[model samples]
Target: MISFDKFYSLFQKNLQNLYKNSKEIESIFFLLMTHIFKCDKTTILLKLSKKGKIHFIIYKKLIKKLWELKKNKPIQYVIGKAYFFDMEFIVNKNVFIPRQETEELVYWILQDNKNTKNSQIFDIGTGSGCISITLKKKKPKIGHIYAIDFSQKIIDIARKNAKLHNVKISFKKVNILNSDIPIQKKINNNSIIIIISNPPYIRISEKKLLHPNIIQYEPFQSLFVPDKDPLIFYKKISFWIKKKLTGIVYVYFEINQFIYLDIIKFLKKIGFFNIKIKKDFHGFFRMIRAVYYKKK
Candidate 1:
């Protein structure tokens, strides 16, 4: 067994090469301790004050995770879980980890439709089912929620997350880019329809701008788009709304900040008016919402 102070010192030293900030290293250390020991921060601090010792088996696990961290693996992936909207989600290499920006996107939807009843929500390119699951959990009055992804493996992970949240989301395996529309069930024409997506908007050329934790660990299919068509997924979703969906339709996207204007322009061209862009906490224009009203 190793004393907590000694183990923490070793942990800080191993993480220094990966994280330049001392506070970040300490934060990660506490996070690891709490996750591994299934205890809270106060308990961890109390143990530390008492000079608690870590069992040999737990020490070995921590060392292995430290090695992964040294490789610049995201702490979320290292722990196999991520927190989003105050909810824990199961994540793996097959699914893109949820981002705080995406949580803002979810909140935007909830704020707009809090009083809405019998609404159908579709989460296109749903990853880990974070957006749909959070919406379902927070807004139980929603009529139905559907989540779609191309990879069956990714869909499986999303299903697991939905199960963990104890929410019923209709998950489907369908490539948004494919010509065939995946949604086939008949819907009430008067019900509000909301479509939300955080699709692959990062251009292939921009891959170098991302960190190793993102480019090396996250699923490639969920992140990159061809440089020539950074808005492919958005375009596809727009066309789907135009061709397949009806009623008072509200569309939301977690957009690439660099292409916010371009996305707004495309949505306007596709007959979606009342478009709005929201800046995230980082002050980047990272989310958009638009509404389409059916002609009388």
Candidate 2:
């Protein structure tokens, strides 16, 4: 067992080798410290720059974990949870570590639905239930949220997250590839205001460009698509909703910035009008939104 200050000093060198960015190292350090000390990161970092001797045993395990991280494993998986959209979720190699961009997607939806009292929002491909849960937290008056995923295990994690947050959300394990979204559930169709997704837009050909953390650790089903047809999920999703949507139904997607025109064309073909492409905070075309309203 090593003392906290001693371990921190030793880990700092390993941190520099493990990550290109100091900030990521800092975050990982804080996350690990919280776990190791069995006290919150804030509590430990704020109160004791040094923890007493039992801390040495903790650092022994932590050093091994840090070695694993340098191999490109996600810290979220290492920590067994992820912070997304200001909420924490149980995460593992079983689920995609929720992305900061997806938080932008949820914030976009919430911003649009701010005036929406009793609005119903659908979070398709609702991995880990981050988007759906965040929506419910931000807009509790929302009539309902229908969240779905293809993986049962991932949905289990999502359900746990919803429970942890004490927010009610309808969850399903049906693969959208073989079946349409379940319309019979708590979807308040009349008030259905938004249909949002952060679907699998990554093309297999583009794999080389992805961060090693995503390529090596994240679930393939949740992160990728066939190179021949990268927009497969979006196309099928659009086809499924064409005849069903009414009211001011809006569809949003977190897009692959490389194929903006292809996505825009697909949106028009699917009958979504007034389509709007939006940039993430970093000014990348990371999201798209469009609306279709039935006749008055």
Candidate 3:
């Protein structure tokens, strides 16, 4: 017979060399191992006592997880899902996981768009389809929404998520790199009222400053652009706005805290008015909202 406390102590000790924060590492291992064993909170106590006697297959799977963590893969990727906007979505190497700050962007849209039954929204770089789907769900009255992405695998997951949640959306597979959305009029009879994006804004310089779990595990295409032109997406978005959005078309973006001032300035120069930058829970310059107003 094995002792629960003793085995846990050994495991924790072995992991200490891998993780500087011993308590968090221990917690991750405990919860993950228990789940791998199919033991809930009630059965976890005694299950540890029989660790060595556990099924070989489950042990092997958990050992694999530990090995991945030792090399710095995010636990969210390992688990194959992540929580966002108070909901769970399938996550993997193919697409970026939905983030909590992005949830705030969705909330802001929902709150501001109470009567969007007739308005049109275009979500550029619709990663995981979180923004587009949430908007459709929140304002079912909306005539239509266009969720654009350049990746097929991510668009596939987004379509699956939309189906799972029973929402209607048009997923467009097109690159927005340098396009000014030449077909804006064809897509909407009424003016496109809103444009939102949490584009790839992380520069190469900042990549070296991120957590190893994210730096190594998450896809660079989703998080970063070439450092030489970190604002590539923003520049294109502003061009689209200046040439396309008329009257009071609202624009929103999730930006790097360090570049908040720079983004706001560019928006102002491009005829964006009433621009605002919002901070996240960590008090970083995280979200920016702007309105495009063309001179009459």
Best by TM-score: 1
Mark the regions of model 3 whose C-alpha exceeds 4 Å error after superposition: 1-19, 22-54, 182-192, 294-296
Ranking by lDDT: 1, 2, 3
**What are the lDDT scores of the predictions, listed in order?**
0.88, 0.81, 0.76
Better structure of 1 and 3 per lDDT: 1
Q: Which is better, 1 or 2, measured by TM-score?
A: 1
Per-candidate TM equals 0.96, 0.91, 0.84
lDDT tens digits by residue: candidate 1, 138-213 = 9888769889999999999999999998999999888878764566577777688899999999998888889777
Q: How much lDDT does candidate 3 score?
A: 0.76
Q: What ranking of all candidate models by TM-score puts the best one first? A: 1, 2, 3
Better model by TM-score, 2 or 3?
Answer: 2
Candidate 2, clashing residue pairs?
Answer: 1-56, 1-57, 2-56
Backbone clashes in model 1, listed as residue pairs: none
Across 69-131, the per-residue lDDT of candidate 2 in tens digits comes to: 778787888889889866789898888888888888888888887877776667888888888
Off by over 4 Å in 1: none
